[model samples]
Target: MADRAGSGTPISFRGIEKRFGGVSALSPVTLDIEPGEFLTLLGPSGSGKTTLLNIVAGLVEPSAGQLWFGEQEVTDLPARERGVGMVFQNYALMPHLSVFENIAFPLRVRKISRADIAVRVKEVLQLVGMLSLADRRPRQLSGGQQQRVSIARCLVYKPSIVLMDEPLGALDKKLRMQLQLEIKRLHEQLGFTALYVTHDQDEAMSMSDRICLMDGGRTVQISEPTELYFRPQSSFAAGFLGEANLFEATLVQQNGHAFLEGAGGLRLGPAPEGARPGSRRTALLRPENVRVLATDESAENEAIGQVSEVAFFGGDTRLTVTLPSGMSLVIRGSTGHGLVKSGRGETLRIGWCDSAVTALPEQSA
Candidate 1:
C-alpha cells in the first residue's frame, strides 16, 4: 500500500474562469483541495462542475487565472504531462486487450520494463480484487467488473491525483452502491488526491470529504455534506442539496425575538439570526424537521394546513400540506404503527422549533 498521508499534492485554483465565445461556462472561482483528500464536484447538468474538473485535469485551460499542483505551476501543462490518472463513465477499456494488458497499458507507455509492469499490474489487480480475472477481455466481464478494471488501470500507475467522471453512472443501483463502497475503500487505502464529478447527491455526500456545489456557471457553496444539508448558505444551496420548504417573508423584530411574517396569515416565530426587521428574506424548512401536532398541543412554531398529498416510502411517510395562505410544505415522519394517519384534504396541524428554520438571503439573478 502507498503512504496514505504523503502520496498526493494539494491543488489550488486561483480565480479560474472559462468562457466560450461570448458566454461564460464557468465563472471566476477559487478553491483549495487538501492533499490526499477526496473532493467531489456536485451539481446538476450545465452547472459547470464538469468544466471545472476538466480544468483541473488539464483537458481544458482556464481563460483566466492560474492553477497549481503543490509547488508546480501547471497552467500551461498538457493532459499527458500532468501525471494525473483519469477514469471515465464508459470504463474506457480497450475491448481487444485482456484485463492484465489494459492495466499495464499506462506503464508500457512510460517504457517500463516487462518485469516491472508484471509486478505493478499484479499489485493493482489484487488491490481491486480482480487478479483472478486478469486474462478476461472487456467483453467478458460484467459492468461492475469492467469498472473495477478501469479503476485498477488508473491506480496501477500510482498517480498522485486521480479524476473520476461519473465512474459508476452506467451500473445498476445495487451495483453502483456496491462500487461506491469499493471505491471509498480503495481511496482510503491508496490516499491519492481525488477529484470526482457526479450529479447524484447521495453519491457525493457518501464519498466526499468535502463537496463543492455549482449552479448556473458559478460556485454556490463548498463545505462538508452535513453542513451543506443543515446550514446551507444560499437559497439555491438549501433547495438543491435536499428537500426544502421555502417561504418568502419579511423580518420583524419582536419584543425579544425575531419573527418571519409572510402573506396570508403565514408566520414563523423566532427567526434565525442576522435578519433585520423589514428586510425581505427566505426561510428553508426541511421536511424531517417539521412534525405533525395534536390539535390541543402548542409548540414554538405551528401551522394549520390541509393535506394535499401523502406518500409512503417504506421507511417514512411524506405529507404535502397546503396552508390557507396557498403555499405548500412537505413533512416527513416515521411510518410506525398508527403514525402519520392524516389523509388528503384533512386539516393537519404541523409544528417545529425555531432552530429548524434556516434564514437565507433572497436568491438573486
Candidate 2:
C-alpha cells in the first residue's frame, strides 16, 4: 500500500459542549485522540457517542470550546475543509456506480487526472481485497462486499483521520467479525488515526486500543479494555462493559484489607482504592472470575446459594445461583467444570479470590 502524504494526526476536544433548546446533548468534555491510535467511543443510545464523533468530523460544531487537528485549530472549519474521511453504517455507496467508480469518486472530485484516479482507486480496492469486484455495482454485491467498498473509498483519499459511525452495524455476526479483523489489519498497515463509535461492548473491546466509555452525555471512564472491565470506577461503568455480579454492601477495613459486608454474612474484599471505610459501595464480581467451590472448601470471599438455572453455551456454561438474601448471582465456567454436579434447588458454595472483586462507588440517588 502507498503511504499517505499526511497519514496520522492527533485530534483534541477542549471542554466541548453541545445543547439544543432546553436539552443538553453533551456536557463539557475534554479528550485527546493520539496519532495513529484506534480510539472507540462506546455507550448506549442517547449517551452522546455519536454527538462526539460528529463534533470531530465537523458535522456538528460544539456550542463551547475549540477543536484541534494536530497543532491546527479547526473549530470553525467546514466538513469538507477538515480533510477527514467518514464511513457510515449504511455503506453509503452510490448504487448506480461500480466499485471502481465509487472508490474513485473522491479523487475525481479533487480534479485529479484520469490516470492518477484510476491508479489510486485500484490500489485501495486491492488493499481491501476487493479488486476482483471492481465492476460490480453496490446493488449487485452482498452487504459485506458493499462495506468493503465503503472502506476502500474512505482509504482511497488517505485522509489523516477516519471517523467510523458503526460501520459494521448492518452486517451479520459472521461478517462483522471478519470485517473487524480486516479493519484492524488496515489500520495497523496504513496507520490512520481512527475514532470509531459503537454501542456493542464486544466490538469496542475487540477493536479499540483504548475505549472512551460514556453515559448520559458525560464521560464515565476511558481506559484500556482490560482495566475498564476489571477495575471500573463507577456502578454504570461496571454494568455497561460486560456481565458483572454486583452486590450492595457497606465498606469496612480490617487491618489493611478492605471488605464489603452485606446481609447474611456475605463479605467480599480487598476493595479498590479511594473507597471510604464507612461509605456504601457496590462489589463487582465478573462472572468468569468467580469460582464455584466444593462443599468443604473455603475462601475469604464466599457465599452460599441455591442453584436457580443453568445454560450451556457451547464451550462454557452459565449458572444462576440465588443467595439466601434472594440475590441472583451469575457465574460463568467451562462446561467441564462440574457445575452441574449441584443440580437446580441444591445448595452450593461459590467463592472468588479477594483480588478479583472490584469495589466501586455506589450509584447516587
Candidate 3:
C-alpha cells in the first residue's frame, strides 16, 4: 500500500512560506512527505506549485519556515549540495553532448573517474530503456526519447530525492500518458522519494501515492488518489482534483443523519458522518456517481432534468442536464452503455445515493 510508512525519516516542512515583493506566493504551509514515496504537488498556474517545489529543491529561499530532509535541516542548503535530482519541463540536455555524456555530466562534476561514470550512465540508460540511444544527441531523439535521457541523467546521480516540475507538460496527450505509466513503474521498482509537480489532475492521480492539492498559495488537502477523489475535505479540493457538481445548501437537522436543502426546493439526504447540522455547507458530488435512473427506479435523492447538451468522448458520453431548478449538472456514462440519443429538452431523472454526497463547511465561493 502507498500509505505504508517506511522506517526512514520522512521529509517535513514546518511553517513554510515564500514571498515575492509585496505578494505572498505561499502562505504558511506544513507537510510530511514519506520516505521512498511518490508525492505530487497539484494546483493551477500561479497557485505556488512550482514555488513550493523550488523551495524543496533549494532553488528558492523561503521567507518563513524551515525545511527538513529526513532528520537533517536543509532549509539553508544550496541546490548543488541538496542531493536532489530534478527533471524540468524542458529537457535540459546539452546540445553538444550525446545521451551517454549527458547522463555522465553530474558524476563528472562530482569528480568521479571516467570508468565509474561510464558504469553508472550505462546502468541508468538501461533503466530508462535508452541504452540504444546512448550515443545520440538531443536533436537526434524524439520528444519522448529525449525525456528518457533527461530522466536517465537525473537518476544516474542516485539522488535521494527526485523533483519533477511539469516534466510531461510539453508532450502530446498520447506520449504523456505513455510516459506516465513508465514513471509509475519506475517508482515502484526503485522506491526513491519523489515530489512531482503538475497541473493535470489525471496525471497526478494516475502516478502519485498521495496528492498535495494547493490553491491560492495554501495547502488545501493531502490524501491518497482515491481518497482525494471520493472524500475531498474542501469544496476547492473537490472541484480542483476532478469534476464535481457543487451546490450551496443549509444543513437542516442532525441525529445519526443530517439533511441539506438547496435552491428551488432541492432537498438532499444526510451527508456522511462528521458533518455537523444547522450550518450552511457545500455539497460535492462526482459526475460518475450521479446516476441517470429509469422512470420507476426509487432513488435516495432525485432530480428531474432535461438533457441540455451531449458530448461523445471515445469511452464515455458527457451529458449536461439542466434541472427543473435551473441548475445544470454534468454527468458521465459509458459511451455504449448510456442512452443512445439525448438532446435538448429531453426529460431525465438524475439521482445519487447518500454515499455519493460530501458536505464541507461553507467558504467563500
Candidate 4:
C-alpha cells in the first residue's frame, strides 16, 4: 500500500500574501516545499503559519501570489479540486461511522468500487497499525487512536500534499512524542510531502526535515534543526528555538581580530564574518555550551559566580549561576558524573569555548 502511494510532488509559493481587508495576516511569502520532504511551519500564534497552510489547502484565498503544485498552478483551484489532505488539532471523525467506513469515505466519494474501497481502507488501516480495530467508532477510540483514524481517512485518498495543523496537540507528552516518530515513519515509508504547522519547537525539531520559522506574520528563518538551534542568524530565531544567553555586545578589534564585548565585559571572539567593528552586535550562547569548570581548569571565556538555582532532572542538571556583574547564566548538562557538584549559595566557575559563541544578525541600539 505504501509503495503504491508514489513519490511526493513538490509545491512552491510565489509571493503569497494574505490580508483580511485592512489587517495583514501574512506578508509576501515565497517558499518552496521540496518533494517528499517533511517541512514544519513553526512559530507562535498569529505568525501566519495557519493562514499560509489554509492557502495551500485552498481553505483561505491569498490576497496576492500564486501557488504551484508541481507543474500545475492551483492558486485559483477549488479546495475540493486540489489534491490536499488535512488532519486537524481535534480529531474530525464521523462518530457514527466505524474506522473502516471513516477511512473509506473519501474513496467512496470518488465513486470507487466497493471492492477497491475495502482493499484500500484495509491496506491503510494495516499501515497505520489499526487494522484490528477497523470496526471501532470515533467515540470508542482514545484521542491518539482517533487522530490515527483521522490520518487514515486522509491517506485513503492518496493526496499529493498532507497538511497537518497540530494534529498531536491534543495528546499527552509521552503520546505526542510517540506519534511524532510514528508520523515521521509514515511520511518516509509512504513518501508523501508533509506540511505541518506547530508552535512547539521540540516537536518541530524532532520531526521536520527543515523548519520554516515565522514571526510577526512573516518568515523569520528556515533551516535544518541543528543549524537553526546552534547558528541561528536572527535574535528571535536564537531565543525561540531554545534557551539562549543573548547579549547586545559592542564590537572590539585587537591585533586585527574581531571581538564582541558583551554585558559584564564578556568578550567573545573571533567574531563571525560580516561583523562590523565598533558596532553593536548580538551574541548567542546556548546553555549546553556552558561548562562547569574546576578551579584549576580554564576555558576561553571564564566567569565565576554563585549558584543561584539548581534543578535536577534525572541524569542531567540545570544550574543558574549569578555572576559578579549580576548577570545570570544558565548551564545544562549531565552533572551527575561530576561536571558540577555545587549547590545554591555555593560559588562555581563556569566557562565555554570561544568558538562556541556565535553572532546573530546584528541589531542597532
Q: What are the TM-scores, per candidate, against the unseen true structure? A: 0.93, 0.93, 0.93, 0.95
Off by over 4 Å in 4: 1-6, 255-257, 339-341
Q: Which ten residues in a row have the lowest lDDT in candidate 4?
A: 1-10
Model 4 quality (TM-score): 0.95
Q: lDDT of each prediction vs. the true structure? A: 0.88, 0.87, 0.86, 0.88
Can you write out model 2's per-residue Cα lDDT over 178-258, one digit (the tens) per residue?
999999899888889999999999999998888999998999999988888888888888899999888878878887777
Residues 226-284, candidate 4, lDDT per residue (tens digit)? 89999798888998998988777888888877888877777755576776778887888
Q: For candidate 3, which ten residues in a row score worst on lDDT? A: 1-10
Off by over 4 Å in 2: 1-6, 253-258, 272-277, 295-297, 340-342, 362-365
* lDDT (Cα, tens digit) per residue for candidate 1, span 1-365: 12357477789999999998899999998999889989899999999988999998999988999999999989999989999999999999999999999999999999999999999999999999999999999999999999999999999989999999999999999899999999999889888899999999889888888999999889889998999888888877888887888888888776876798776746775665675678887778899888888767877888889999999878799999999889999998798833457789998788898888877755520
Best-performing candidate as measured by TM-score:
4
Clashing pairs in 3: none
Regions more than 4 Å wrong, model 1: 1-6, 295-298, 337-340, 362-365
